[model samples]
Target: MKEKTSSNAPTDTELKKWQGSSVREKLVQLQSIFETTKDAKLHTIAIGSSHVSFFYLSSMAAEEKIYDEFIPKLINAGEKSIKSMLEAVDSANTGELQKVLSEIVSGKTAVFLNNEKQVYLITFRNKAKRSIEEPNSEHIIRGSHDGFIEDLESNMSILRYRIQNPDLTFEVMELGKKNKAKTAIAYLKTSYDPELLKEVKRRISYIDTEIMLTPGYLEEYIEDDPWSFFPQMLNSERPDRVISNLVDGRIALIMDGSPTVLIVPTTFFAFYQSTDDYNSRWISSTFIRLLRLASFIIAINLPAFYISIIGFHLEVIPQELIVQMKNSVEGIPYPPIFEAMLMELTIELIREAGVRLPSPISQTIGIVGGLVIGDAVVQAGLISNLMIVVVAVTAVSSYVVPSNEMSTTVRLLRFPLMIMASIFGFLGMTFGVIFILVKLCKLESFGRPYFAPAAPFNLQGLTDTFIRLPIWLKKEKSNKTGSGIFNKKKSSARGWEKNEN
Candidate 1:
């Protein structure tokens, strides 16, 4: 029987030891030397030359296998025989060591010659990926509907296909102490802010971890304050959105093996924006923007409004509506706050259950829980019929914001406002709102004011911020200095047309 060797400490003697052996034996010996070390995906394969050959630990292994029959094959070379052999030896391009390493680590076969200093990389990577399809979250009418997939290389290809510019740069780095997950940053050198870029690089370099699951994982790590309810970075799946942010001097961080990309130096108001705003007509887009703002107010404040009015400001209710409201709440022994809390908690549970379930069952959970529980609770007098109405409207309004992160922020803020309304009525609600605004005003994204064009007051950037003004009317570009807005080119100019033409 063959004796099994221990995977740790193969050396048995203190003075004398084995000098060298075959590659396979050496690998087995190394495995025994360091059993605790992980992430050693070592393997071996046959390398092709002019003819079939064998190689192992010693450089002379190939010469030992060489036969007299192979002499003719080596002599029968073509006009470009040397070039063909060199090309065959070099699978991937020169000056792309990192890319070669990436492909090799992703299960590709790489050949390291005993004589040559460099290694030849060839892909055997056959991991099946999802086909390109429309983005579910970010639908568009006029632009490309296809979104990024889980494969990082394919997503990078999408960007390269769109921009095709030399200035567009991609810097790759490995994160995580153990996993060493690959993370990349893409931005236009001419368009991005140098200081902001340095800051982003600095923050990313400071991340100390292993195996980042997604772009959001890094987002949580690099966030100015994770304890704060608001998200400091924007996670986007749309390539166009990333490109647009790049054009606006924002840095986009793309993680390898993760579908989502992150944009930094974002503001609170930036979350409220949708790609549809750019696709639609200015007048309609501006109206939609305002409507979304109203939805945010409705989502956060409507429930608190109802609580304050029913619990304290009874005079504000109309007489007929007051009678209906009273009828709805008559049998409920709990105060307005408790009723609101109960319904809110139920809604949250239903939402969470739906999200956690499988795709087919998630829809079922949403419908059954939302319709059934809401109806049953109202019938049992656990919550008022009017309160259910308020909850439904609130849920629908929360979905208006394009960003799920911001929607979650508003949802969380509702609880505090509800509690405050229950305590001091409208006055308490007002105080809570003032607190939120104060927090927003104080927030900073990479030292840049979060409430740009609003608090510090840059009138020029407002051409597209809250309102989607006409393209022609947007004469000025975004100013990073918070200075007066002025167009580099006139709003109407034939010289620009000639130059562009």
Candidate 2:
């Protein structure tokens, strides 16, 4: 980059200082920059009477593109004809030495032209990338199966396809130091707050980190609360999910080489909701949401409740079930907390193992390993069958949350609650729940309510927080200003009913 350029200037648009005003001098400076790399190819090729020099990285397989698509199409008569041919193809002339070097490093071909007033950058970047396919973790039976690939341009195209509005904006920023990465942010200009977008950009700008390999890296750096267990930002692989929130006036952070995108200013309820919820009937969707909420409760509190009952409040167990439970735990040498922790950690270990192993073996390990471990634990009286049932159900319930980050938070929140329950019975669980609620209410994601609706109690937000409204009852929300609050787009979606009446 140019020494005169502000150090904080985003690398994507920043210009680099040129060595001289000639094409040959620019090529010499380019070679000097990559003097140590053997993969860098700088050559002088003749076209008619004129010889122009070009520079590219050989490792990117750009030579084939230059010969196949570039040379034959553009180089017949000389510099003048070359200029005309460049107008027909995707190419740009940049005087910034660093900009051209960045393009070359990223696999694009840079040719010097206009006597080095500007370097011609042509698109010869790697063409092969992961095909758009369904995301494994966020798959839905009734929603769009297409997910984002590692390429940022392709992801932006997917978003554009779904949101064809003119206000939709996609801007790229260079993140990391020494090894800068292209990080992009997408949002609808009219829908989101300009100040909010500015703050996001500002935070990204001031970051002093050297690498941002994934959206997670960006999320961690920019999130408001680093110490909080709750994720202030939501990460998702589904394009439909991202666009839905994008239309809702949220910002999406995308990184090159990472499929995951981070959506900011998300509420707690967003994690509990899914794309399929809209695809199904409203009644079914509401029911499923309720089920998920119930699962959330059960997942975090089930084992803890068991500990309270067995260790502190035995009388709360029903007389009919008391004998079965007592008999089951009678032979166990450890306390309820011990058994609960053992089983929970074991389940987490199995999950991690399954994830790390190959697909075929992971499935086998999750199923066969879980079954064998549970059966053996119960048979040996190390863990009760009742406890096994509770742990298994809890594991399933934690995974019910659509967002994996939130799901993990739920899994982790269980331990502290379990410890509290074991010590003070229902009272400890009460404190735990109260503390979590207080934290949620107090936390803010990008200066927006993280808990949302419930904390501020916006009636409109609440309408779709716990239970979604029927499609017929739902009205479109449009933000004319930058408030990012719900404003009725129209009087009604079913206004025909009033006319008929």
Candidate 3:
């Protein structure tokens, strides 16, 4: 039989020595890929006998850069000559088809010459994006308002601008076999523990899914206790917050399309912290920290505590308030637990509704929904006045938490405690508290204690945790265990004031 050749195959005369597969075959494959994509743009230039092609995704690749800078460079160096093509864009050369596809996926233009095996990749990914603004959810009165947008490179630049330390490093990886989302794990080389770094990367490596597009999706996989109510990592959009955490020996996970970065090995106290805490005076910050801790306690346990007192331990109530409390619940139709759940769920529904609505409408929904509903229920006698007071206080306290994840967790923890308190009164509340404390002490974030400094009882950590001391006193230094707690400085800078001179 005579040799058969396909029409798409290059002729014997057209054959040229190249490092990769035949140009015609690669072109056929790439053409198919381009056909699948809606915005794939390919421009081919003909040389005397050979050809050169530029392939890019119009949606992601910057057209101005491709045409004005890159193509001009390639053509100026002489697209007619293959040697000029190689010399012009010689930096990012890749022979593998997989690498070419990877670059293309990352919004880089890929150039293929007829005779060369390697593809020339030029990066001009679309830079026109949302400007860094204060994260509406995490706004602080005093601090850099520049928050992270959905661009990973921009976020990295923001971090680099703030933390100029040489030890700061980022490890970028392409995750998801099908989705191919880019993610970077950033940490200080000399600060964060090598073992914890390994563990973070190791957990990420184990992620086997079709899509890993969001940080939240990744967070679920790497958490120490997925079943636990507490968040293992802290979500932050503020560059200042990320920088402070990084300086204190924490690792940040930045995904390409996420405004929020995940800070790992986060402690229970971490969620309570805000950027404003650092910007404010130490005494005021300490007082506010204590208040937040109190709010956290009240948010999770206030309703439960009320139910306990009303159902079982009214003796603990002061003499003056006994009749008032009794009168409040006198005509109520349901038990305290039933009404507490009703109010809690109602608030949750309202909050969720507000979140789902547009900004202007959301604020209206929050204020009107809360006030109207609370007032209506109290008037209709669906919920008692005292119960309404407790629920309102609880809802307000939950909102005081700086971390939304922790806020949600706090709200959720309210119900179980409420149930326990209503059933067995004060004893149940005590057991519930003990159980939560035990879990908190036991819970770990990337193998580090979630309830650190308190569980391990480090005095230095307390200065920054329960209370804020002068920055000069509390310095985060690496201990032998790599706990990353604030160690007392060798000598106080303010000690000079003590001298009579």
Identify the candidate with maximal lDDT: 3
lDDT of each residue in 1-501, candidate 3, tens digit only? 333432223234323322345766666667664555668788887655668887888888898876787656656656455555555553388876667767776788887777667778877788577987999889888878889999888899999988888888999998887668889999887777788788888998899987788999999989999999999999999998888787778889999989999988788998998888889999999999999999999998899998888888889999999888888888889888898899889989998999999999999999897789889988888888888788889999999999999999999898889989998998999899999999999998887888888987887667678888767665556522334455455545567767857
lDDT per model, in order?
Answer: 0.71, 0.81, 0.82
Error of 3 at 300 (Å): 1.3
For candidate 3, list the clashing residue pairs, or say none. Answer: none
- Candidate 1 vs 3: which has more TM-score: 3
What's the ranking of the predictions by TM-score, best on top?
Answer: 2, 3, 1
Model 1 lDDT on a 0 to 1 scale: 0.71
Q: Model 1: how large is the Cα RMSD against the reference? A: 6.7
* TM-score, cand. 1: 0.81
Candidate 1 lDDT trough over 10 residues, lowest sum: 52-61
Model 1, position 219: C-alpha lDDT score: 85
In order of appearance, the predictions have TM-scores of: 0.81, 0.91, 0.91
> Rank by lDDT, descending?
3, 2, 1
Clashes of 1: 4
Give the true-structure RMSD of model 2. Answer: 4.4
